[model samples]
Target chain A: MPIIQINLVEGRDDKVVSECVREVARTVSRTLDAPLASVRVMVNVIKPQFFAVGDVTKAESAAQKDKS
Target chain B: MPIIQINLVEGRDDKVVSECVREVARTVSRTLDAPLASVRVMVNVIKPQFFAVGDVTKAESAAQKDKS
Candidate 1:
């Protein structure tokens, strides 16, 4: 089974998530020449504070209002 | 950024998820030589019905109780 997991810190709306799954599924199906039934996708959303870069958390950057 | 996403049909408990995140973060850090703060891990839980194999959904297999 081919399973793809997408990580997102933002854009967690129902529309976006569903559309993403569809698009990713199509891409995986096409590239791997696999049936849609065989491809699996997972979208994992993390909180802002839990994800960081260079010791600066997303929450910190959001607090600065894109000042980075 | 190197992001790793893990898909799981089961094991969605709080303890399991948190431990998974920590373990994945550490692995990424060690293997890729990335800082712990820089590695991101997302755990996506998928429903049984939505996932399938060979036209047979996970729900179907689950219903069959490992009769595959």
Candidate 2:
């Protein structure tokens, strides 16, 4: 069984989310030679405030960029 | 950096969810001897309709259980 977990920033369109899920499942299935039906894909969307890099959140980064 | 992804069924109390995230990060840090600040824990809450086992969604399983 191939389980794929995807982490994405929140606020994407529903169509984009569904397409990403489908594409990921298809790619994983083909690459791993696993049955498409047996593959499980889960997507986790994180708020910008909750996602961070180098201790600075994405929300904070965006705000900083707006100031400069 | 130790990044931990946790998959959970949706509808838990917000307090419980926060506690779980804190506890998991602490446990992973302790067990792996990684710095607490370096451990990242992401929790993915899945709707019952989106989660399945043996091709039966959790929502369907609960409905069947109710009938039985």
Off by over 4 Å in 1: A66-68, B1-68
TM-score of each: 0.52, 0.55
Task: Specify the highest-DockQ model's number.
Answer: 1
Alpha-carbon lDDT of model 1:
0.72
DockQ of 2: 0.11
* Residue-wise C-alpha lDDT for candidate 2, range A1-68, written one tens digit per residue: 88867777777785566566677777877888888779877667789999999999999998999999
Please write out the lDDT profile of model 1 over residues B1-68, one tens digit for every residue: 56766676753565555566667778778888987777766655678888888899888888899775
Tens digits of per-residue lDDT for model 1 on A1-68?
Answer: 68997767764687988899999999999988999899999876765544555444566668898775
Candidate 2 off by > 4 Å: B1-43, B47-68
Worst 10 residues of 2 chain B by lDDT: B49-58
Residue lDDT tens for model 2, B12-60: 8989998999999999999999999999998878866555443445566
